[model samples]
Target: MNTVKINWPNKKSSNCSPGVDWLKAAYDADIEIPTGCLGGSCGACEIEVNGEVVRACIATVPDKKELNVEFFSDPYW
Candidate 1:
């Protein structure tokens, strides 16, 4: 399996199986992101990857190269 390194907004590094736990990666990144519901319906774990908002809870983990993700705390509106 390929190891994927996720670069978070706060500059933290973590590893997880592809399409597994993207949320844990963000939390390990030392980013104080918030989520109302752990479930993937509340839309609270939304974050930006370059410039797009991706729900960390549902976002698939990277499988090949490490991905760069910039998360927004209270990023809504």
Candidate 2:
């Protein structure tokens, strides 16, 4: 199976297959990505993937060979 490299903000990285659960991948990398609702309604689990904001709860790793992920912080959250 093909895999992609996810580069977290902490300089840590992990390899995962395409379409894998992003939250699980983040957890495997020891990266804490807060989530309020796992149903993608609360928007608390928002994150930036390849410079685009996506809800980690409902999103999966893309087919890209490398993904740069960063936490999307919201003061209101």
Candidate 3:
């Protein structure tokens, strides 16, 4: 199972399991990212995955996709 480790800006480590979805897993882990709706339609929970800005609520956890789940806390740019 391919896994991607997420390093939060606060230096927290999170794992995105092969079967476990990233967004859901993060939320379940109580890592707490912003989310207006769980349904990925609002695009509120945007994140910068590997330096590329993406809507986390809609984006799927790609295999080996390294994500820095920090932008969730600093949503300015």
Candidate 4:
């Protein structure tokens, strides 16, 4: 399986499979990414991945050279 390096906002990094669940991978790396709905219906689980805003609940890790991910916070979530 192919793997990609994910860099978190906390300055922590982890090597994960491209098909892995983003939320689970983040959690395994000791990073807590807040979530609301597990599905893609709600926008509360949105996150920034490689400069793109993606819904974590419905998005999977991608195969990339490296992934820089940051949590997307909404004042009114």
Candidate 5:
């Protein structure tokens, strides 16, 4: 199985298989991605993947060689 290289917001890196849950991938990288709803209703788990913002709670790692992820910063949060 091909794995993807993830560059987390905290500068930590981890190798996870494609299609892996975003939350699990982040956890494996020793990073914490705040999540309010696991069903993708809340915006707490929002993150930027390869410059595209996505909800981590309802998204998975795409099939790519490398991915750069950034946490979404909400001023009201």
Candidate 6:
């Protein structure tokens, strides 16, 4: 299986296999992705992957050569 290079918002990087959970990937990289719910109900775990917004709680590391991730910041939250 091939691995995907992930560039996290915290400036940390991790090479993870495809189909891995986002939370796991973040954990492996020693990065914390805030989460209000383990499921996809809340947007607290929302993150931008390759410019696409997705809930980290319910999303996996997609199969790609490299992915740039950014945290979704809520000014009010």
Which candidate number maximizes lDDT? 6
Displacement of residue 59 (Cα, Å) in model 4 is: 0.6
RMSD versus native structure for model 5: 1.1
Clashing pairs in 2: none
What would the TM-score be for candidate 2 when compared with the true structure?
A: 0.91
lDDT of 4: 0.86
**lDDT tens string, model 4, 1-77?**
78799989989888988888888898889888777888888887889997799998888998887999988876885
Deviation (Å) of 25 in candidate 6:
0.2
* Predicted structure 6, TM vs. truth: 0.92
Error of 1 at 38 (Å): 3.0
Please report, as a residue range, the 10-residue window in candidate 6 with the lowest summed lDDT. 68-77
Model 2 per-residue lDDT tens digits across residues 13-71? 89999998889998888888888879999998899998899999999999998999888
Better candidate number, 1 or 2, judged by lDDT: 2
Q: Is candidate 4 or candidate 6 better by TM-score?
A: 6
* Clash number for each model: 0, 0, 0, 0, 0, 0
Residue 21 lDDT in candidate 5: 93
lDDT per residue, candidate 3, 1-77, as tens digits?
Answer: 77778777668777777545557867755676678886777767777767777676667766675656657444453
User: Measured by C-alpha RMSD in angstroms, how accurate is candidate 4?
Assistant: 1.4
For each candidate, the alpha-carbon lDDT, in order, equals 0.69, 0.90, 0.68, 0.86, 0.90, 0.92
Which residue pairs in candidate 4 have backbone atoms (N, alpha carbon, C) closer than 3 angstroms, thus clashing?
A: none
| Candidate 5 lDDT over residue span 1-77, tens digit each | 99899988778889999999999988888899998978999898999998898999899999999999998887897
Candidate 4, 70: how far from true, in Å? Answer: 1.2
